[model samples]
Target: LTVTMRQRPSFVVVGEVRGAEAFTVFQAMSIGRYVFATFHADDIETFIHRMESKPINIPRNLMLTLDVVIILSNLSSDRGSLRRIKTVSEITGQDQLTSEIVVNNAFTWNSVTDTNPYSGFSYVLKRIAEKEGKFEADLEKEVDIRSKILDKMIEKQITNYKEFYNLVNLFYKDRVRLFETLDMTEEVLM
Candidate 1:
């Protein structure tokens, strides 16, 4: 799998990260390739700790290339058992001590307050702004537009996976058509 991916793959997806192959996954990310893999850990802290220990031992420098780490947990609330994202951590880089990776507090879900589904600034957004040569506020506006698109999808009961993906792609390809189909004004996207 690693050999074929290295040849000329857009991205690589691994079921899980463990053993010797974990290093290869990190290597793939370092060389400007996207690698998505699941790791067994309760949260971001535990996830980072695990990566630095024992058999996996992913390098701190390699860890710097990571974009985001999403922590999902199954919580029991009055509503019922629900699985959701607990926190989202953005990897900024490694600390000067070279002991661990540095992460920015992106967002967290507060079960008690439930004020907003996500709270806090996103480092990934800032990174995206730098990459796209746009101001952070512009990127944030784009995020808002995308959020509105998702909300419209749910409200209109667009539940099928392929359908959702195709719709989003259509929006990217033909903004005016997608906006008209979704009953959203093109100005809203701007």
Candidate 2:
């Protein structure tokens, strides 16, 4: 399966990383391919440790290619059960002396503030900005705008997959049209 996947250029989605296939995922990521995958672990640190140990045994340096780690947790409240992204961390690099991977906290949800504040800086974003010849701050602002577009979609209950996909594409093609279609104001997003 890995051989077949490598033949073509595409995004790879591994349902779970439990065996030697984990090596393939890491290799794909290192080669500038996007991979979406899920693995069970208590937290980000545990996830990295698990991947570096036992059946997976992924090397530390190769792990640096993993740009983002999004942690989703279920929270029980008075209203009902809520599933939210607890944190978004970026793999900065590995410490040469300690041989430990460095993680940068890019975004975290604050219960007190009831908001997710982004640091506007991450290793991956810096690379992307450099490649695109734009400042990291510009890329960060684009991310903020896109996030607001998604929020508007969910708030409006536009749940269908096709509808959501089209909306996002529309946003890229014509930002003004997207705002008009969603009945959203740029001021609110700002």
The backbone clash count of each candidate, in order, is 0, 0
Give a tens-digit lDDT track for model 1, residues 1-190. Answer: 6786649687988997778888888888888888888888998889988887898998777777789988888888889988877778888776777556777766777777752254447778877789889998887777778878887898899999999999989988997788888898865746
Instruction: Report, for every candidate in turn, its global Cα lDDT versus the true structure.
Output: 0.80, 0.83
Tens digits of per-residue lDDT for model 2, 1-190: 4875658667887787788888888889888788898887767898899999998999987888899988878888776997777788898888989988889888888877657788766788898998999998888878877878888887999999999889879977988888889887654357
Model 2 stretches with alpha carbons more than 4 Å out: 188-190
List the candidates' TM-scores in order: 0.86, 0.90
Q: What is the model-wide C-alpha lDDT for candidate 1?
A: 0.80
* Model 1 deviation from native, Cα RMSD in Å: 2.4
Model 2 TM-score relative to the real fold: 0.90
Looking at candidate 2, what is the lDDT of residue 100?
Answer: 86
Query: Which run of 10 residues does model 1 get worst, by summed lDDT?
Result: 113-122
